[model samples]
Target chain A: MNRRLIQWIAVALGAAIVLHVAIVWAIPRVIMSVAMKRIGGEGSVNAFMHTPRTTHEFRAVVRPSPDLAYSICVLDLSDGPVVIEVPASDPYTSLALYSAITDNYFVRNNRQDGGLAEGETIRIVVAAPGAMPADVPEGYEAVTAPTEKGLALVRRVIENDEAMPRLDALRKFSVCARAS
Target chain B: MNRYLYWASALVAGAALAAVSIAWAMTALQGEYRSGPWYTSAVFGSVDADMYTRARVAMFGLLALDRRETMYYTAATDSEGNALSGDCTYRIEGGDLAAHWWSITAYDAASFLIENEQRVYSFSQTTTEREPDGSFVIRVSADPQEKNWLPVKRGESFDMTARFYNPEASIYADPSAAVLPVIVKEGCK
Candidate 1:
């Protein structure tokens, strides 16, 4: 009630308000934003974001329910269009994409035998029902040609030190176009 | 002097109250403490659960009681079914507890449910056929078909996990101490 006492009380209240605002509101928001940005900004990569690493194996999978059988084959051709037979499907569908389930990136490291180096181009023709999803690595050309039943996927891999093994392995697997 | 004493008393009271309030706020903020293999399989990596990656921490295992415990087991695999950096051995043992439900299941690297004809992954008190002694045996191996078997496939990387819900106080107090089942390798075919 005294004038001096009232002024002192007012000053103390103002100081407390300032401290609370600085510590609770401003500080936590700023810290959280920085942390979130660091976790999610450019150059940040989760396991899903990286190119899928695969081993040498012809993988085939059928979903738990009777739907379609998904199979992957890796093959290499010496010097011709690889011959493939399409399987018949009951209620026809399309070929989705050729990608590693993990990173969804094309398996690189394809090459022709007999010491063929980089800058050598190979042509491929795929025949199927719908669009064939092709995932070529960076700086490569992979085009899909549509077929009556499915889609044709064709891609050329230029092998250097990095892509030699993967590309060569992929060239070995020529997925036989088939329907289920 | 009286005024100074009054002001000091008020300040002391405020400090005490603030300390107690801060303690209360912290306790409130630490909401709903839980332990064990809590999984929300709805999300990728089941990220919503507390995935303990700390060194020296024991990863929780789970069992599905619907199947024979002997029919379910796994070889360790990477998150992607790719090979992990190392090889580890594990087993499952059962224990007597006051809980209403419990079981263990095995998963492969892909995390997609493993395929088996019977669809039994592990045994629980509810589903397992008990012995006369009230004890049970569940097999963990690549070939668990002899009886009470859990199957492990060759070149297949997998994980064995167990889950116990509505557990009695004794089991909750010492889960690791519970009589977990034995893990055996029938041999690689």
Candidate 2:
């Protein structure tokens, strides 16, 4: 009610307003930065999975250069089937999908280990969920890749669609044939 | 009376403004999780029931959330250590299921892969083949055979997730299982 009391109240109100602004503006940035530090990049708690290598080295020739960083590896682990390993390639960078490589004998529900028989040629392609072509090799339905989890793959071509031919064509560029 | 009214009005206005600002901030945060033009949340729930079920099955909760448990999601296991499935995809690549292993996988909010041209997904484990000193490499591209691969398909947005199974207990006392990394490669034209 008095002049001094009123002056004190005004100061308190101004301080409260400043405090409110600081809380609103600065808190989120601080929280996010801390969170990011914990889960910010490769090996962060928030990553889908750490790949075997930092960059993907595709043995095949890319088409018009797909949109993303990639490394190509074409080495024959053995003188056996040519197995193609696919990654989870999605336009959406946030959602991480589980993937796998498989031979053409496994069922859609059942899974098989990836010790391919000698001389078998397996084409491995990676894409986001539902991105896999329907035309997979016969006997080989998609199974989760062993190295990576929750992904599916096929050993044989079940669908005789155009994707198989296109993939075959691409395989020509992937002649590195060694796992090392 | 006029003075009292002015003071009261100012106080009320300030409180209301603060409340509105806080509400706006919260709403903006929620926007980050919204679906795109082709899908509504309800529709996403319905259309991605299978994927949703899988995530639930994997993490044993809605949205693969378990605040009390490990930070990175851990898959459900039976007393005997068998990983079950609710149609969600997951694989064990390298980490020692018992100790020192790491994995990377993909899933959306609904726990399914966004539609795309390739169906293949790959995750390599810590025990996955590595260079001489135990350091390893993974390939993340449409073509996995090129070497180490982590796939990212085309969609408006999605999540790439990693899991460290039985990580080196010393990394952090409260290590998270779901470690995420920004895998966006610029200039993919």
Candidate 3:
């Protein structure tokens, strides 16, 4: 090829690499921003929004499992720390924390650590990196979040239709609030 | 003027190429592990996930847990390597899974549940009926089946996702060795 054409080819190749990296790096953050806004809805930051069972009509999230009931907390640690409390239930239950970049940093399930007994609760304090408070209260496990803004999701398995009412009641008791 | 025109054309072509290539990569590239028609990635929701994996998961799974908490396997083809179509019927057979809870859900090309009159989108371990040997069979088709029927829209393509919650260590070590369901195409209209 001619020298001028070679120069053009090199310019195009450089542009392609730059654009590729920029898009790839931005996808997760952009998608998570949209998701946090949609999931957070009218609820204030660090508060739980108990969603109904997943079904065909549910469009907030892709690949939602119809068998599980979801309660979402859009965490914003800009103030300080957030507290997540999951009530004990008979069915399978789990609390998962995701960073703003969409990485699941921490997960605690009902079956883990010999499982939570009835009337017990899983309490977690989520704080920004290097912002953990000294007074986390008793029985509350503290975790450092990778980002100031993140998400905490609770999933409760719905065994059957008849169990929906009871399970829904139990899941409603779950709490997400700003740590005082 | 000629130099300016050349640079502008070259830059536009480069950006266009990037967009097309990224779209192709997201759709064509499956995860790192493959078993029959299903595939999964060990770093799905891990902090170690690369940019491409994170981008793909953002588009497809969004907020997925790591493999230890939940293993997600997806299949868009049959055992014979044919694309799963709503025009066709498939028989999905499997035995027990190594997770505390498991379910198989169907999603459209956009990864949303397939709409149907029955409002049924998945068959879980707690819901599926098993044979005397404890093995189970599920039917995937537009038409209704007497038992274990997963619906799809006619003339559209779909995919199936099998989620294993709290999977055993054996599955995490070797996902390909896990006893995932077999998707065999039965017939087509």
Write down the lDDT of every candidate, Cα atoms only.
0.33, 0.31, 0.89
TM-score of chain B of each: 0.46, 0.39, 0.95
Each model's backbone clash number: 56, 127, 0
Model 2, A1-180: lDDT tens per residue?
798557546755665576457555544334323323332233322112222211223211111012212222311112222234332221111111221111111111011243333223334433233334555556433423222222121112112223334333332332222212
Off by over 4 Å in 3: none
Instruction: Please write out the lDDT profile of model 3 over residues B43-154, one tens digit for every residue.
Output: 8888888889899889989989899989999999998889999999999999877898899999998889989998889999888989889999999999988789999999
Candidate 3, residues A13-67, lDDT tens digits: the string is 8888899889989999999999999888765688888888778888888999999
Best DockQ goes to which candidate?
A: 3
Docking class for model 1 is incorrect
Q: Which segments of candidate 2 are over 4 A away from where they belong? A: A1-180, B1-69, B73-101, B108-111, B115-119, B122-129, B143-145, B166-168, B171-187
TM-score of each: 0.29, 0.27, 0.96
User: Which residue pairs show backbone clashes in model 3?
Assistant: none
Better of 1 and 2 by lDDT: 1
- Model 2 reproduces a share of the real contacts of 0.02
> DockQ of all candidates, in order?
0.01, 0.03, 0.79
Best by lDDT: 3
**After superposition, candidate 1 runs with Cα above 4 Å error:** A1-180, B1-93, B173-176
Error of 1 at B174 (Å): 4.8
